[model samples]
Target chain A: MHPVAVVNANGASPIVFVCEHASNNIPNMYHELGLNAADKISHAAYDPGALGVLRCLVNEFDAVGVYGTVSRLIYDCNRPPEAASAMPAKSEKIIVPANANITPAERDARTNAVYVPFTNTLADIIAQKGGQGIVITIHSFTPTYFDEPRHVEIGVIHDDDPTLASACVTELQGDGSFVCEINEPYSREDGVAHTLNLHGTKNGLQNAMIEVRNDLIATPDDEMKMGIYLAQQLRKTFKSLGIDLNEVSA
Target chain B: MHPVAVVNANGASPIVFVCEHASNNIPNMYHELGLNAADKISHAAYDPGALGVLRCLVNEFDAVGVYGTVSRLIYDCNRPPEAASAMPAKSEKIIVPANANITPAERDARTNAVYVPFTNTLADIIAQKGGQGIVITIHSFTPTYFDEPRHVEIGVIHDDDPTLASACVTELQGDGSFVCEINEPYSREDGVAHTLNLHGTKNGLQNAMIEVRNDLIATPDDEMKMGIYLAQQLRKTFKSLGIDLNEVSA
Candidate 1:
């Protein structure tokens, strides 16, 4: 399968949506990367319901979406491939046997085959939108990780540029549907801001990554509602910011 | 005018060179961006001698080089657009009148006109190289800043991926020509690693930025010698790493 699936590649909207942990389908060749049935479906593999929400967001915003096609068990697309976490030997408390004892050459192979394609595709999408593109990455976290519960529902993540994320948090705060925080759940130091740094801030694109609590999007219907709500709030934010989405190309 | 100048864009080499602070030319339209002639040639405007060294690298390795056309004083190509440092109001105690009290729209305009094109062009070059692309950024720094003196002559900077920078440091040791350090002069936090983070590690490329003391490249002949030495050192490093520069399209 292709490393990434870009929805609405030719769409007119200037905004680009990214779902880095969108899939959990391990290839048959790797034999589920030595994981039990339950662990395979766990958050350690991928964000449970982010793809569904991202799809709804695409439809709502008429935007371009870049979605990873493989499970993080094979390769975490959000990570810099040279990092050991990119092909983690263990995530959370579970050991990934297939990731153990890998050679540098093998690691490079996975990066070339998977991570490179994903990056190249996303880069192309950003290039098409010119400099005025807005990047909105979608991600999710479990309500309880290892035993600790997270209460924040929306996390607006940023690196050096807080302007866009600040705008997002301001608009999200008044909605009152959920608790919102700047750099909560994960910050740039957590390595969660890698994608935004590469695609959004690097090119000076108005960018933000929204992290939703997995429990808040447990069901398909719930995910859809969250997506619609987010899209509307973002629309209002853009309108308030005076961004003409059609004027992205410079 | 084009925001970026690509030298040997399709050269059959794995490495792509970038000189982000190559120029000190502020377009005539902005009226030199409200800077005096002295400030225009100051370290705050551009990195002295970086372009000359970059040219030698491109020539020696037959590699692709992407050079920024405008001054960093206008819109720092290496910085994230939303970061205030990208359009600094002051650098090393020198005030930039044009950068001070600018509206968001004006800031965005400069980013759109200069930063976007440079980013898009580099992305296209990286895309063409597929997964085997290696990024090498060239820069120069002042001998003294804020009443402090620097003894190091060379700085090999990296973000997350240390493979390439480590290789260069190992090769440069005992060269008898310069003092070298990894992550010196500037690091990721200094915002100096912006290009490496965005274009290199983010895409899983073997990458590093080399910073030389400006005094070392004060003359045309000195620049040429420094450039030749750098090219030879880099060539030796690549050979030691078993990197086939022509085989970059993985």
Candidate 2:
């Protein structure tokens, strides 16, 4: 199976959905990157409920979805090749043994095998939409990191271009659904905005990165609820931005 | 005028030619970034003859060409926004007054105005070519830097992936025309491979960066000769790579 998976590749919608941390399943070739069974399925491997939310949103808008099929521990699709976190030697407190002091050739192998296909398919799909494409990346963070609790439930993040994110934050806040803020938890300075910077702001695409607290999206039903609510808010976001959804290549 | 110029946007060829430092004309809005007339047109502002060669190659193979239309002093499209050289305050000996002490907002303005459009156009064009795209970035460097003389006439450079660069270097050396060497003059370690790494290696495209001495390509006629020779060698390189030119798009 390919490291990247695309759903509704020819979807008519102008919106492109990306889930960089969609799976915790490491490929057999990686041998779980030297992690134990429990640690392999940890949030470090993938965003626990992000894929479920992405699927619902893809169906909600008939948007094209591109997601990672292998563990981000192998290669984080959101990171640039030069970034250390792209293939982290230490993700949080857990040390990734296989990633420790990896050679340049070994690093290139993972990048070629995983990051390339994921990004190319995304770039191709967005190109097929011409100038009307909007990108929205979904992710979920742990309720706590390093014994510190994160209060922000949803993050509406943007880098460089804030048109979509500013509007989404307003819509999310107005809805009173959950605690939402701009650039909370992780910002562009944190090196978490690689996807938003590369595919969205760099391409002049109206884009936003949405992060939900994992506790809020722990189950399939929760994912469905969050996805439906977020979709409504996003639709309203476009409207507030003076964009006509009906005319936006649905 | 747009910061980026795309020639033959719908060309059937599988090659996407990029000239990041194509022009030395800073827009009126920038006021030449506080440089004098001579300094504004210096090799530091833009590559002297890279665009000429790129145009010749684009015509030779009917390949799509995406080039920067503004001076690199305003924003180097080849460098990422976070890179200091993207809008360098001090380029060689000339200090750019406007770029010095620039705030984040000021930086973002230039990135949005110049870098974003230029990269988006190139990325879009490459995506249009699908999986068969080959990226070749054209650049020209000064014969001397910081009072030190250089001997290499043409530098064939690569980053993580060396497939295309190695093949092209072998072909260039076999021809016995120019002093061509693999990763000569400047290698990936010199931070000159941003374009090659970002748009080329990151996407898994067969890619190489060709750097010719500015003195060698000073005239339009010289650019044409160099272009024709490089094009032929690239054709041979593709043949050696087991890629049938006839089977490729165009």
| Model 1: residue A194 alpha-carbon error in angstroms | 1.2
Tell me the spans in candidate 1 whose CA falls farther than 4 Å from its real position: B1-250
Which residue window of length 10 is worst by lDDT in model 2 chain B? B216-225
Model 2 agreement with the true structure over A1-250: per-residue lDDT tens digits: 4788787787788899999998775767887788986677678888977886897799788889998877788899999999999999887788889999889998999999989998898888888888788899999998999999999999988889888999999988998879999998888898888887888887888888999998776543456568988999998998889887558784
Model 1 preserves the real interface contacts to a fraction of: 0.00
Off by over 4 Å in 2: B1-250
State the DockQ of every prediction. Answer: 0.01, 0.01
Which pairs clash in the backbone of model 2? none
Model-by-model lDDT, in order?
0.83, 0.84
RMSD of 2: 24.5
Interface RMSD, Å, model 1: 25.5
